[model samples]
Target: MSKVIVLTGAGGVLCSTLAKALAKEGHKIAVLDLRKDAADAVANDINKEGGKAIGVAANVLKKDSLEEAKNEINNTLGTVDILVNGAGGNHPLGTTSNPHFLKEDLLNKDEGFKTFFDLDSEGIEFVFNLNFIGTLLPTQVFAKDMVGKKGCSILNISSMNAFTPLTKIPAYSGAKAAVSNFTQWLAVHFSKEGIRVNALAPGFFLTDQNRTLLTNNDGKLTARGTTIINQTPMGRFGEPEDLIGTTLWLCSEGASFVTGVVVPIDGGFSAFSGV
Candidate 1:
C-alpha cells in the first residue's frame, strides 16, 4: 500500500538516496530541506522517475518553518504516514583537533588545534539544537497527524557516536546520544497511540558533512577514515544503498512490532573493538 512520507533533510546524500528508494516503492514523498533548490531537485528527480514527490523548504529547528511545510505537505500529499527525521550534522567549531586532551597542550595551545576548552558555546548549542531539538520539534508538529492513526511510524537518524563517542566531534556525539534516548522516549510515549518511533544509528558513510574530515581534496582517505575502516570488521565504509533494506523493512509492515530500537547500519564498525 502507498503512504505519504515526509522526509526532513531529503536533499542530503544519505536521505536523498533513502527518499528515492522509498519513492520507488510507491510512497508519496515530501522532500523537505532547508535548501529549497536541493529539495526541489530531489523531488523533481523522483517525479521524473514516475514517483510522486514534492519539495518543501523547511527548517527542522523552527516550529513555524515545520508548520508551514506540514501544511503544504498535507495539502499536496495528504496526511503523512511516515516521518523521517534526517536533518542533523556537525560543525567544525564543535570539533576538537586532538582526540585526547593533555594538560601541557592546554598551556601551549597550537593555533591550528581546537581543544575542548576552545569549543564555543554557540557551536555546541547549534549542534545540540540541530540534532536533538530538531528531531523533537518536527515530531511535535507532525506526530499530531499520526495520533490515533494506524501504521504511523517515525524514523530518526542517529550515529554510532551515540553508543561510543568518537574523536573530535563531542557536540555531535552528545546530541545524537540525546536523539537515541528521545527515540525510546517517543516510542513509549506514543505506543498507546499506535505510533512507532525508532532510529537508525549509522556508522560511517562518506557524505558532504564529513567529506573533508574523511577524505583529502585529492580524494584519498585521511588518518581518521583509515582508522575507521581498519576498525570496522567488514573493512569498508557503508554506502547509502546499504541502508535501504533496513529502512524499507522498518517502514513497511515487516517491522510492525519493532519500535524504540536503534538499529546500527554500520559495516560492523560497532561490533569490533580493534582487539
Candidate 2:
C-alpha cells in the first residue's frame, strides 16, 4: 500500500536517509528542508530510483513558511499520511564550557561567555523554540489531515541528550527533553484520533552538522567523540542507516499499538552507567 509521507529537514543527513528508505517502500514523500537545493537533491535522487517525491523548502521556525510547505505537500502528495518532525539542532552560543558555573568566570568577559554563566538568554530561547515549538507547529499544521486516517503516525527526532544532559549543551538537552515530553503528550492527546506519535532518539551519528565537533578533518573521532564511543556498549558511532529499521517499523502497520514512546537508536549508550 502506497502512503504519503512528509519529512521535515529532509536535507539533513538522517532525514534524507529516512526519506529515501520510505520512498523505497513505495511511499510518496514530501521532502522539506530549510535549504532548497539539498531538499531538491534528495527528492531528485528518490525520483531517479523510481519513487515519487517532491522537494519543499520550509523554515520550521516560521509559521507561514511551514504553511506554504504544507500546501505544497497537500497539492503534490495528497496530504501527509506520515509526519516526521526532523527539523531541530543546537546553537554554539547556547552552550557552556563546563557543566557548572564558577564565580571567577563571571568577572572575566572571555571566560564568562565560555562558562555556564555565559549562556545567552536569546540563544537558549532559540534552541527551545527550534526543537519544541518547531515540532509542535508542524504537528498543528499537518496532523489535521491525519485525523481518522488509519496507520498514520508521527516520528520526532530526539537526541541522547534528552535522556540526560550532556556537558556544554544545556539548551539543546533541555529542548530535546521537551520534545520527548511532547511526544508522549501528543500521543495521548491524539489517541482517539487514530494517530500515533513517537520519537527516535539517536545516540550519535556523524553528520555535517556535528562533523567538526565529533571528528577531525581526517575523519577520526575527536577526544570528546571518542569518549562517547567508548561509553557505548557497541563501541562505535551510529551511522544514518542504523535508524532506518525503527523508522520503517513505526511507519508501517507493525507499530499500530506503539505510541508515546522514545525509541533510542543508540548502541546501548543510554543503557550504560559507565561502570
Candidate 3:
C-alpha cells in the first residue's frame, strides 16, 4: 500500500538512503532536514527515479519548526503514516578525550585535552536536546494525525551507545538511552491508537560525519575504529544499505505485529563480550 512518510534528517547518510528506498517503494515521502540544500538534493534524486518526494527544511530542536514541516508534509502528501526520527549526532565539544579522567587533569588549567570534567554544560545540553527532544517534538507534531490510523508507525534512530554508554560521548549515550526509553513509553501510550513506536540501534556505520574520526587520510580505519571492528562479532563496519532491509520490514505489513522494540542492525556488536 502506498503510504505517506515523514523522514527527519533526510539529508544525512542513513536517512537519505531510507528516504530513497521508501520512495522507490512508491511511498509519498517528505524529506526534512536542517540543511535545505541537502534535503532538496535527496528529494530531487527520488524524483529523478520517478518517485514521489517533497523536501522540507526544519530544525528538529524547535517545536514550531517541526510543526511547520508537518504542515508542509500534510499539504503536499497527506497525513504522515510513518515517521523516522533520524536527526541526531555527536558534537566534538560534548565529547571527552577519554572515558575517565584523573584528579590532576580536572585540576589542570590547561585547555589542551577535554576530559569529562572539561565537558561544557552547553555542549551537553545541545546534544541532549538534539537527540532526545528532537525525537519528541517531531512525534508530537506528526502523530496527531496518525492516531487510530492503521499502519501508522514511528521509528527512532538509537545507537549502540544507548545500550552501553560509549566512551568519550557521555551526553550522546545518555540522550540515546532516553530515546530508547521514550520509544517504549510512546509505543505503549499509543498502542490503543494503532500507532506503533520502535527504534533502530545502529552500531558503527562510517558516515560522512564520522569518516574523518574513524578513518585516516589514507582511508584506513583509525585505531579507535579498528577497536570497534575488533569488538564486533562480524569484524566489519556497516554500510548504509545494511539498514534498508530492517527499515523496510518495520515499515511494511510484515512487521505489523512488532512494536516497542529496539532492533539492532549492529553486526552483533550489541551481543559481543570482549573476552
Candidate 4:
C-alpha cells in the first residue's frame, strides 16, 4: 500500500537517497529542507523518475514553519503516514580540535587547536537543538495526523555516537543520544495511539555535512576518517543505499511491533569492541 511520507533534510546526500528510494516504492514523498532549491532539486529528481513528491522549504527548528509545511503536505499529498526527522547537523563551534584533552593545548595559540573549554556555547546549543529539538518539532507537527492511524510511523536520524561518544564531537554525541532516548520515550508514549516512533543510528556515511571534515580535498581520508575506517570491522564506510532496506522495513507492516529501537546502519561499527 502506498503512503504519504515526509522526509526532512531530504536535500542532503543520505536523506535524498532515502527520499528517492521510498518514492520508488510507490510512496508520495514530501522532500523538505531548509533551502528551497535543495528541496526542489530532490523533489524534481523523484518526480522525473515517475514518483510522487513535492519540495517544501522549511526550518525544522521552527514550529510555525513545520505547521505550515504540514498544511501544504496535507493539502497536496494527503495526511502524512510516515515522518522522517533527518534534519540535523554538527557545528564547528561544538567540536574540539584534539580528541583528548592536553594541558599544553590550552596554552597553544594554534588556529586549529580547540580544547573542550574553548567550545562555544552557541555552537554546542546549535548542534544540540538541531538534532534533538529539530526532531521534536517535526514530530509535534506531523505525528498529529498519525494519531489513531495505522500504518503510520516516525523515523529519526541518530548517530552511533549516541551509543558511545566519539572523539571531538561532544555536542553532536549528546544531541543524538537525546534523539535515541526520545525515540524510546516516544515509542512507549505512543504505543496505544497507533503512532510508532523509532530512530536510525547511522555509524558513518560520508555526507556533504561531514565530507570536508572526514576527507581532505584530495579525497584522502583525514586522521579522524582513517581512525573510523580502521575501527570499522567492515573496512569501508556505509553507502546511502545501505539504509533503504532497514528504512523500508521499519516503515512497513513487517515492523508493526518494532518501535523505539535505534537500528545502527553502520557496517558493524557498533558491534565490534575493537579488542
Candidate 5:
C-alpha cells in the first residue's frame, strides 16, 4: 500500500526519521523543509535506499511557498494521501529564564535573563504562527487532495506540554495545545470527507531544536534535562525512532476508526504525577 505522503519539516530530526521510516515502508515521500539542502539530503538518503522520495523546499508559514510545494508534489509524487505537519518549534523569546515567576528576577535582571515580563510579542507570535498557523496552512493546501479519497490521513506534531504545560516555554505549550484542539476540530469537520486527522504529542526527545536546553555542550544532561529524565517513567530521553511505531499505526488502516485523538507518544510522562 504505497501512498503519496508529504512531511513538512522533514529536515528536522523527528520528521527526518519519520520520512525515512515511512519511505522504507514503501510510501512515496515528499521531504519538505525551509532548508533546501536539508530536505534534499533526507530525500537523497531515501532514494539511495531504494525508497521513493523527493526533496522540496517550502516555508510552512508562507501560503505561496506551500502552494508551490503542493504543485510540485502533485506533479511529481501525485496527490498527497498523507500529510505530517512537523514544522513547529519554540523560540527563546517565548520562554522565561525561570519556570516560576520571581520578583527579584524582574527587580534585578541580569544579562540574558528574561522573565515573563520580558516575553516579546514578536517572539510569542513567531512561536504561535510557526506551530499553529504552520499546521493550519499546510492542511488547507494539502487536505484538499485527500478529500473524498479513501485511506487518507493527516498527522500533526504536538507536545506533551499541550496536555500539561511544562515550565518556561509558554508560547510553545499554548500553540501545541491549540494544535491538539485543532486536531479534534479538523477530524470532526472532515469526518464525512473520508479524511482522518490526528496528532502525536511527544514528551521529551533530544532534537537539535532543544539540544541546547536539554543537554550541555559537554554532552551531559543539563539540570532541566535531568529533571525530565527523572520525571519520565522510562528514565531516558526518547529517541526519534521511538515515535515510528505509533506513527505508522496511526497512519495505517488499523487506526481507521481513530480520529480526533491526540495520542501521547511520551513514555508515561503524561500519565505520571510527580509525587
Candidate 6:
C-alpha cells in the first residue's frame, strides 16, 4: 500500500537508506533536512529510481521552518501518513574526553581533556534541543494532518543510549531518554485520535556521525567500538539495511496494535550483561 511519508534527516546515511527503502515500497517521500543540497540529492536519487520524492529545506528546531515545509509537502505529496523523526545527532562539544571520571584528573586537567565539568552548557542545550525538541516540533506540525486519519503512524529514531546512558556522550543519552519518554506520552495522548507513535532505539550503526569515534584513521575498531562489539552478543555492528525490515513492519498494518513502544534493534546489545 503506497502512502505519503515525510522523513526528517533523510539526507543522512541511515534515514536516507530508510527513505529509499520506503520509496521502493511505493511511498511518496518528502526528504526534509537543514541542508537543501543533501536533501535534494536523496530525493533526486529516489525519483531517478522511479519513486516519488521531493526535497525540502527544514529546520526542525524552528516551528516556522517546519510549518513552511509542511505546507509544501501538503501541497505536493498530499497529507503525510507516516512521519519519521530522524534529524538528530550529537555535538562534539557535548562529549567528555574520557568515558569515566578519575579523581586525579579533576586536579590535573590535561589540555585536551574534556571532563564532565568541562562540558559546555550551550552544547548541552543544543544537543537536547536537537534530539528532543527537534522531534517534538516536527510532530507538532505534521501530526496535525494525520489527526483522525487512519493508518497514520510516527517513528522516532532513538539510540541505545536512551535505555542505558553510554559514557562520554551524556547530552545525547539524556536527550534520547527524553525522546523515548515523549514517545509514550504522545502515543497515549493521541490514542483516541488514531495516531500511533512509536520509537526505534537503534544499536551501534556505523554512520558518518560516529564513524570517527568508532574507528581509527587506519580503519581499525577503536577501543570503544571494540567494547560495543564485545557487549553485543551477536558480535557485529548493525548495518542500515538491518533496520529496514523492522521499519517497514512497524509502519505496516502488522503493527496496528503496537504503540508507545521503543523497539531495540541492537543485535542483542540491550539483552546481554557483561556477566
Judge candidate 6 at residue 257 and give its lDDT.
93
lDDT per residue (tens digit) for residues 180-255 in model 5: 9999999999999979999999989988889998899998999999899899998888899999998999999999
Clashes of 6: 0
> Candidate 4 at 190: error in angstroms?
0.4
Q: What does candidate 3's lDDT look like per residue over 1-275, in tens digits?
A: 99999999999999999999999899999999999999999999999999999899999989889888988888889988999999998888899886678777776666657988678899999999999999999999999989868999999999999899988899999999999999999999999888889999999999988899889999898989988989999989899999999999998888988899999999999999898
Predict model 2's lDDT versus the native. Answer: 0.91
| TM-score of candidate 3 relative to the true fold | 0.97
Off by over 4 Å in 2: 100-104, 107-113
Where does candidate 6 clash, by residue pair? none
lDDT, each prediction: 0.93, 0.91, 0.92, 0.94, 0.94, 0.95
lDDT of 3: 0.92
lDDT of 3 at 182: 98
On lDDT, the stronger of 1 and 5 is 5
What does candidate 1 score in Cα RMSD to the true structure?
Answer: 1.0
Error of 5 at 263 (Å): 0.9
- Stretches off by above 4 angstroms in model 3 are 107-112
Candidate 6, residues 89-148, lDDT tens digits: the string is 999889998888888778865676788888999999999999999999999999999987
Note the residue pairs that clash in candidate 2. Answer: none
Over the stretch 160-250, how does candidate 4's per-residue lDDT look in tens digits?
A: 9999999999999999999999999999999988788889999889988888878999999999899899989999889999999999999
